[model samples]
Target: MTDANTTLPKTNSSPWTSRPFHRQYLMRQANNLFDFFEAPSLNPKGGFFELDDEGKALSAANSTRQVHGTTRMVHSFAIGSLIGRPGSGEMVDHGMDYIWNKHRDAKHGGYVWGLDDNGVTDGTKQAYGHAFVMLAASSAKLVGHPLADKMLADVTEVIERRFWDEKVGAVREEFANDWSQITTYRGQNSNMHLTEALMAAYEATGEKAYLTKAERIAELIIAKHAVPLGHRVAEHFDENWVLDKQYLGSEMFRPSGVTPGHALEWARLLMQLWILGDKRLSWMTDAARNLFRQAIELGWDTQHGGFFYTLDWDNKPIMREKLWWPVAEAIGAAAFLSAYDRDDYFQIWYRKLWDHAENHVIDHARGGWLSELTEDLKPTSRLFTGKPDIYHALQACLIPLYPATGSLTAAIIEAEHTVKQHH
Candidate 1:
């Protein structure tokens, strides 16, 4: 964080306002490039739900591709949330297919945790898994996709079919094939994420059902998830919102104030709804602030510009390595702030984030972002950053110098060197 002021560039321009229109659209073309796969999900996991011809699995491997998958989902969803507008019918058709193909539990209609390397369904309905649907559906509507409204309805079916819990009005964290609550592993992280997703949907549609879901999740956060002793959130919980150690396994819950990654994501999603007069989104914004501030106080590296991979409950640096996702989430949160906040405090973090990441993650010499980096903004591992996943062209920019206006596809055609998994 030492370079916050020194490395950052002074811009007199407005935060919301971008560059020249033609150039802006050119960069945006890169954003649109991922619609082929990176942006849309005909089914949930990878949205494509099978291995590509090269034998790359359609779904992200949590461990096999740990470095990229860690935060790729957020970036993917952020991009997809904006481009994948679908209808209720499309949402259901697509969701059910994925549930059946990649995510579905064999015994029930609910989705599986995610797919495996063989592209097989080892079914479990993780809370994070379902949140993907909610977030995508909400963001799709914002971009006027023909299927957006129906996609919202399709996700509603998922909630009614599997996510909704009548007694709690909040989603239980996980479930068996039939959507029965996983009693042994009770909790609220999923609920919190679900809240974040539902908030996005609520803002996009103004649907009372979504708001009801958000409010209930908020109640669950305040009641059970929020640390009574501190401002952070417990990563796991019991059915009654009691602390549950067993569910956390050998990996003791780090008990940080709140994960900056999740907190910033919540802030962005909620802010989308805020301008429309939904005050509930404020919880997301406020919670993000608390968690981010806590990170600064407890987890930030005074010598390094980015955040640590993990921080302990009392703000101790349990894992001090810098990971890529936090930077991306921070960028997103700051982008929201630049657009909405009057003070512009977020730019401090946002600027540091870019400077740090570009130094490490962005491989200017080789191309694309690097897979990982060290505490000193150097590579810690091999250049296994990521497979060349696609994205909407609107967000993709080869560089600020050359954007994808009329030639994103053409750039791919001309690109002789590409980073990909060798089958």
Candidate 2:
């Protein structure tokens, strides 16, 4: 294996921040991915069709059109539209229409989990999915989509009324169809995503309430949950929001043990939260740095070049297969930390992770990315089926290029304004 450290961007230097032309090129490549996933040829019955590994639309038999997937595409395109990419608003409109018309339960109060050609296949109302819907709506609102404001308000209401637990300062996990029964399971994963959505909400609407909710969540997860458990963010939890270290849930979503990807992801979010905190909450910076350090020390596979998907409580790699999103989140975490703190180690990680992605994850021929790779660095798909979604990969490329002071949606808007002013 090539020495990843040797190929890194010069230590202690911020190439992504200093080199404008290269940053433009990289951001364009990321935008091209949004174009690739637009999938104009594929028919959109309710939502945009899922793309295969090669960027073509998956066949109807293979497509279940997850709410999170559809909302992510909408959120991505809404960012594109905010950045002045043509045809992006149209895509955002399509996704918005689908979510409101098809994915939302007319009978129940929240969005369904998944839909197919026939109709809603999985009808469970998940906080995770609803969080994405809020994110999508927040971004859409920013770009002035006709339905975005109303959708944002509606989903925000649903989240507050149905999912949020103000008493616990976090959200409940899921509910049965018709919102008839709620589960005893509490999860950090959903709340992490909720924190992300709330940040966007606060950015879009200038609502301090959203920021308040987000801060509570970060305090619970990063300060309360992860710090007590050696900085490894626990994925599963009990009804009391107590850590459930031995709970073996679904392989894809609710697996046992700590997911390093999530820790790195939360690290990034915490930094963003800190940045949005207007320089108060000095502990946020410390906590963010600690999470990044913990994830790198525990999640990184030193023998190979990428991050492990899951880690046992002992910080040992549980799932050895290297999924693409973890590396993407790692890159974002490194980029944000490097930019904010100017740490040489983070700069090294920023370069090393991009090198790893260039060598293994990015699909040069196919145009998007390889979702899964074996420990030997060969492409594999034991976990993810295809280029399922673009949220993590897109952020990995774009966040490093922007100032870490605001949300990406707001950063791109400011960037566009700056470019106009320079001209």
Candidate 3:
């Protein structure tokens, strides 16, 4: 392992960005991830299964299927199909079938949160999960899946009628299965992800409404809320859009105080939003830089060689355990910043972050990345069970291979068009 105090050798030119060798390395990593999850994740009875460390399903039957997990599988495999990976279309089809048949609430308007072989487990409809539903549908649509358009349109209506708050320019947090409000709580995490899905929807369908809503969300969350807090995004908010500094929900999902991982994610999302809008959002570039800088300065542990999970208002580390997703998000944010600004600073951080991931987070012996590590970079599972997600880690590998112009799907489509024209 590389020493924590040592710096990687610097070069005048970026050693990895846009280079063919690096692209091949990234492609291999992406393929290894697909190999790890593709077979084990397929639960024949309904939706997907959660995988263990050795890439085996935790439960063969009657396992809980969360909406986010189901949707993420669809989105990831759709990318695989677009990239010409064999057997990927089958996985996408399986996930799409399960999402439509099982996860969708036929009795209620929107999708349910969790399901098992028997029936619904948690019927609460959440904006966070629904955002992923839209994302899955959009990615499937990009790959021309049969049910993509139907699912996309259905989720769009549900979001508009139930979640979207026109008065505040963001979506409400949660609701019961019967379409009743579950809480007056509002959250930036949901809105940030919604911004991501809305962009994917626009790329898939070319609908101005989707793009318009995405812009509204960026303005409300990043420009209005985060800018004042020194680019540290507050997680919880009240019904009237007031900040809730004391709010604590799920340790894995909603931890108290500021989450630097989220700020890194928003940095990447804001950059994509700026690109999709033809660089019309001039302020977003600066905001993206600031967010990235804040996350690195406050969240990254210089001696421990990883990002802390959470920080207090004073920017001190609250959750000292380092997690994989934050490192993944930082790699992505670094890639975007490196491409946008053409700066060696972002490039240096990009290499450093990848080095940390390859050394600590990635299970070189196993097929997937470890979810959690102690501050000293030892693997631990206190916060996450076996490797249940590939969304963040996969993107961290693949996003750097594509141009920083738009979302991954959009970049894939553009690449395909470019190749065909040359042929």
Off by over 4 Å in 1: 1-107, 116-120, 137-154, 166-169, 180-183, 222-230, 244-258, 280-286, 365-368, 380-423
Give the CA lDDT, 0 to 100, for residue 3 in model 2: 35
Evaluate residue 119 in candidate 1 and report its C-alpha lDDT on the 0 to 100 scale: 52
The global Cα lDDT (0 to 1) of model 3 is 0.90
> Could you tell me every candidate's TM-score relative to the true structure?
0.66, 0.95, 0.97
lDDT of 3 by residue, 45-79 (tens): 87789998888888875799999999999999998
List clashing residue pairs in candidate 2.
Answer: none
Top candidate when judged by TM-score against the true structure: 3
lDDT of 1 at 25: 43
**Candidate 2 overall Cα lDDT vs. reference?**
0.83
Can you give the lDDT of residue 271 in candidate 1?
50
In what order do the candidates fall by lDDT, top score first? Answer: 3, 2, 1
Every candidate's lDDT:
0.49, 0.83, 0.90
Off by over 4 Å in 2: 1-14, 40-42, 420-423
Report the C-alpha lDDT of model 2 over 1-423, residue by residue, as the tens digit. 223353344553545557877688668768767767776423457687767777777776546888898899898888778766787877888889999998988886789998888888999999999999999999998888888888889899998998889997999889888786667989988999999999999999999999999999988888888887888898888889888888988878887788988988988898889888786988888888888888888878888878888889888888888988888898888878887775566777777788889888998887787888888889888988878887888888888877787778988887878888999
In candidate 3, stretches whose alpha carbon ends up further than 4 angstroms from where it belongs are 1-12
